[model samples]
Target: DTAVSQTPKYLVTQMGNDKSIKCEQNLGHDTMYWYKQDSKKFLKIMFSYNNKELIINETVPNRFSPKSPDKAHLNLHINSLELGDSAVYFCASSQLKGTDLYEQYFGPGTRLTVT
Candidate 1:
């Protein structure tokens, strides 16, 4: 079984459109995170949820939101999508210890294109 999976593998939308990406992990992990990888291939953490509680929230724009319905599902909603929001969004889950990570598993990623 896949440890982590994201839906809508590819998304294309015009500027100002709103879209959502869904992620699911079956690794029985308690901590999940969302990361954005830009064209330069730099990864930045956007949000982290531990046991369905908001833990680490980065300085992301208000247009971007992260929601965790349960331990295994995390969803991202983007409003007023801009050209700069065109990047690969990754969903990851790991057994977290304080500020450390263990056995982190990542989804293939959802590539978003804002035209």
Candidate 2:
């Protein structure tokens, strides 16, 4: 079983288009997050959900939204996608409290390209 799965590992689309990226995790963890890694390899946390509740949200554009139907799934939808959004999007998860450690396991990542 996959710990985390994201569809369409690579996506290429024209600017101003709309797209959605699906993600799921089977780790039975309480917290899940979405992070966007820039071309420079800097990872920025975008959204975090705990048991279908939005917890952490960074300063992201309104065009981007995160949906978590259940504890195992978190999806990202983008409107008016821009070239600046062309980066690797990663889905991660971790426990809210455990082992005195805050470790996050990341998915392989979905590479989105806006043309």
Candidate 3:
């Protein structure tokens, strides 16, 4: 079984379109995250959810939203998509085992292209 999975691996749309990507994890981890990989291959954390409460990174825009319906699922919604928003979105799950140790497992990623 896949530890983490994302649906609609590829998305192609025009600017101003709204889209959502769904992610599911079977690893039983309490913390899940959404990351965006830019054209320069810089991966940045957009949001983090621990037990369904959101902890969004300050740099992320309000147009991006992350929802975790449960511990095993995290979904990302983007409103009024822009060309600069085109990037690979990754879903990850990590467990806080001890004081400050965490091992994150990432999904394949969903590539979104906006025209």
lDDT of each: 0.93, 0.93, 0.91
* Residues 43-89, model 1: lDDT tens digits: 99999999899898999999998999998999999999999999999
Stretches > 4 Å off in candidate 2:
99-101
For residue 12, model 1's alpha carbon misses the true position, in angstroms, by: 0.4
Highest lDDT: give the candidate number.
1
User: Which residue pairs come into collision in candidate 3?
Assistant: none
Candidate 2 or 1, higher TM-score: 2
Candidate number achieving the greatest TM-score relative to the actual structure: 2
Model 1 Cα displacement at 27 (Å)?
Answer: 0.3
Question: In what order do the candidates fall by lDDT, top score first?
Answer: 1, 2, 3
Off by over 4 Å in 1: 97-100
Q: 4 in model 1: Cα distance from truth in Å?
A: 0.3
The alpha-carbon deviation from the true structure for residue 17 of candidate 1, after best TM-score superposition, in angstroms, is 0.7
C-alpha lDDT of candidate 1 relative to the true structure = 0.93
Q: Decide which is better by lDDT, 1 or 2.
A: 1
